[model samples]
Target: MSAPFLRGVEALAQFTAREGAGAAPARGHIERLLVDGEEHEHRLGIWYANTKQRRDKLNPAQRTALADLGVTWA
Candidate 1:
């Protein structure tokens, strides 16, 4: 997977961790992550929407990751 892909997944995981189960982020939601000692922000809600729309293009691992985060559409 690409770095951006992993980062987006990581962002969602962090969002899920903080928001708890059965929570869906708002469309403008953003999540921040620290990688290699640097901080990055991900537009998590936008990413989730886009990912759900493009679900057919996602590989098995990607789908599984999202599903593990309790994403119903995944």
Candidate 2:
């Protein structure tokens, strides 16, 4: 299960790297990093301008939720 999950994450990471590298919005960014000591993986999405403008922006937990397929923000 972990192997397949990792593969999917790797694929998404690759796609994001190749496509989002140039097309990511100026105010936003997304990247993937191995987490939980590399046994687990996560994606990080950053909205710099939104954070700057909203001092009370939603916390990570509140701002993120698992999709139908079960991906979550880290």
Candidate 3:
């Protein structure tokens, strides 16, 4: 397992677990990560998501939920 892969997975999981309210989309957006084994050439983006709904804009309730999830947006 690569560090990039692990970081990406961890971030994705945290984002999903908090964003997905049992019905939220399981799909994820594209993200990039870097590993120690390679140079800039080793950087890559992996798209991974497993939910039921698509994430668009957050509603008032959803925003509150996100805050509760410890996510502070600017």
Candidate 4:
């Protein structure tokens, strides 16, 4: 991934860690990252799917965020 793409993912992770998972700001940041990183759809999709598989470990907000992004175990 490019620096900016990695930075966006890092920012999202940091925001979730600091603000608690699923915060609206964090979700919104993730949405922006998705849009900005559209060129990396395959990688993002893989990440999303992996996250979805770990949904049980995620907070409600985090799960919802992934869902909103179309991540699904099915």
Model 2 deviation from the true structure expressed as Cα RMSD, one decimal place: 12.4
Predicted structure with the largest lDDT when compared to the true one:
1
lDDT by residue for model 4 over 24-67, one digit each (tens)?
Answer: 34222343333455732223334444555565776665555444
Instruction: Indicate whether candidate 1 or candidate 3 has the larger lDDT.
Output: 1
lDDT of 2 by residue, 9-72 (tens): 4534554556653232243344445555664332323332343345355444433321222333
lDDT (CA) per prediction: 0.86, 0.39, 0.39, 0.46
lDDT of 1 by residue, 1-74 (tens): 77777888899888889989658888899888898899988898898888888999999898888899898888
Q: After superposition, how far is residue 53 of candidate 4 from its true place, in Å?
A: 1.4
* Total clashing pairs in model 2: 0
Candidate 2 Cα misplacement greater than 4 A, ranges: 21-74
TM-score of 1: 0.89
Ranking by lDDT: 1, 4, 2, 3
- Which has the higher TM-score value, candidate number 3 or candidate number 4? 4
Better TM-score candidate (1, 3): 1
Index of the highest-TM-score prediction: 1
With candidate 4 superimposed using the best TM-score fit, by how many Å does residue 50's alpha carbon deviate from the native?
0.6
The ten-residue window of minimal lDDT in model 3 covers: 43-52
How many clashing residue pairs are found in candidate 4? 0
Q: What's every prediction's RMSD, in angstroms?
A: 1.1, 12.4, 11.3, 10.4
What is the alpha-carbon lDDT of model 1 when measured against the actual structure?
Answer: 0.86
Q: Where does model 1 exceed 4 Å of error?
A: none
